[model samples]
Target: MPDQHSTLRAQRRAETQRLIQAHAVRLFTERGYDATTVTDVAEAAGVSPMTVYRHFPTKEDLVLIDRHGALVAERIAASPAERPLVGRIGGALIDSVAALTGGGHGDDLTADERFLLARLQLMISTPALRAKHLDNHYALQQAIVDALGDDATDPDAAFHVRAAASACLAALHTALVRWAEDDGRTELPELVTKALAAAFGERIVDTPR
Candidate 1:
């Protein structure tokens, strides 16, 4: 009974956080970023202003964090080390996309994809948001580095892994931006795979037997 209650409570908390984030985005879209207040979002979400603040400490975070970055980081960290480094990274990226889109691998953007695209658009349109996004890039890279582990201890392998990670990350960002600009006409997985191939040559697409 206690375990069930804890599970229910956790579920409710997640729901509340999602509710707050959704309302905040709506408010941001309807009103300008500067014009939207925490109180307004709280009212729309049917939660207290403090609750909104607790869920998202800053307005920028409300737009920047969809929790997908953490998901990708977790997936990469959990990925088996025996695979080729780029292959592992690429597979982890695809897994993250699948989880984010609720299991679709098609060209069309899911509802969640659209929501994230809106946030990306918002960030690109606002200078402050763009700066915040850049700041987050390092943290995201660090997460990848941590996931990749002692590859960094050896100078040669360290350089190679860092370069590979950077190329992969750049490929991902390019794919996302291209998808947004094209209005989701192209499949994200295809774009991602293509970008990685271009960046890493044929190795990214090679399958292990």
Candidate 2:
């Protein structure tokens, strides 16, 4: 079973975040990302502008977060012990895409398939959102560390876990971005599948399992 607390936290986070993104994206699409103010989105979402600041400290965070990040965090957290680590990650990415596109694992990327793709493009085009995206990658990796077993007898082993987690996340991000450029107009599964293979292949080949 999934950790209810984690699932609830992620649900709340994505709900608040998606609400913010939906509004911000509308404003940005209408007035442009650079032209629109945080106040604009806050007004649209019906929250006080300051309440908007609380949920999104920076305007860019509104663009940076979407349903996908929260889903990825939750999927990895819920993965079972019997699942291969790389398999868990690849599965999580696929699940996150389902949350994004309302589809299955092998579906190719959908171009602005919905507001989700638009939000993704917005983040890519904006430098601030790009940086927040990087921060999120590391944050998710930390959450993965906690999930794996925080009770480490060997401190060095913990560091190794974090390092491996970071590398895996970095690859996922790179693969996703490249997939975006293809605009979901090209073969999407190949890009992500290759990334999955690269990430888990090295470790799997060396491990006994």
Candidate 3:
């Protein structure tokens, strides 16, 4: 019963955050990211400014909030332990990218993909957001390193794992930036696989057509 209640609370919190972020994105789109205020987003979301602040402490957070790290971690956990570390991490990243873009091609984007595209465009155009986006990249790198657990404990292993994680993430980032630049006209999963192949010398994983 307690577990169920805790799960319900978490679900409600996530829903509130999603609602607030949706309002923030709409206001940012309509009023320009620089012109929109948190209070305005709060009012539009029908929540107090405090609630918005609780979920997203910084204005940049409103645009940059994402579950990429969690997604990557989940994929890594599901990967076979016997696989090479770099391959596991690289494949996990490709799978996560496929999931993000819904493995579809061209301009037919889902609602979530459209929202993500809008966020990516804002991050690309806004200096502060771009800086924060790089910081988020580091955070994601750390998440991948953490996922390696005991495998990264040795000094050499740690260095290799960190380097590999950074490289794979760079590949994923390149793919995402290209997808946003092309206005979602290219299949994102294919771009991710291609980027990883260019960096790693072969496809990390087979992306479904």
Residue range 1-209, candidate 3, lDDT tens digits: 99999999999999999999988888887788999999999999999999999999999999998888988888887788788777888888877877776755566788788888888888887888998898899888888878878878889988998898988888888988998888888877788888988988774454322
Q: What local lDDT score does residue 202 receive in model 1, on the 0 to 100 scale?
A: 68
Per-model root-mean-square deviation over C-alphas: 2.9, 5.4, 2.1
| Candidate 3 deviant stretches above 4 angstroms | 206-209
Among all candidates shown, the one with the greatest lDDT? 3
Predictions in order: lDDT: 0.75, 0.66, 0.85
User: How should the candidates be ordered by TM-score, best one leading?
Assistant: 3, 1, 2
- The Cα error of candidate 2 at residue 70, in Å, is 4.8
Off by over 4 Å in 1: 1-3, 77-80, 102-108, 150-160
lDDT of 1 by residue, 40-110 (tens): 88899998888877878887888876666677678877777777788777767766766765433335567
Q: Lowest lDDT 10-mer window, candidate 2?
A: 103-112
Encode model 2's per-residue lDDT on 1-209: one tens digit a residue.
Answer: 47998999889866776687788987886787889998889888887888788888888777765445567768767766576665665666655655556332225434335465566667788777777777777777766666667422368867776776676676667767775665554344445556766767745423332
With a 3 Å backbone cut-off (N, CA, C), the pairs that clash in candidate 2 are none
Q: What's each prediction's clash count?
A: 1, 0, 0
Model 3 quality (TM-score) = 0.93
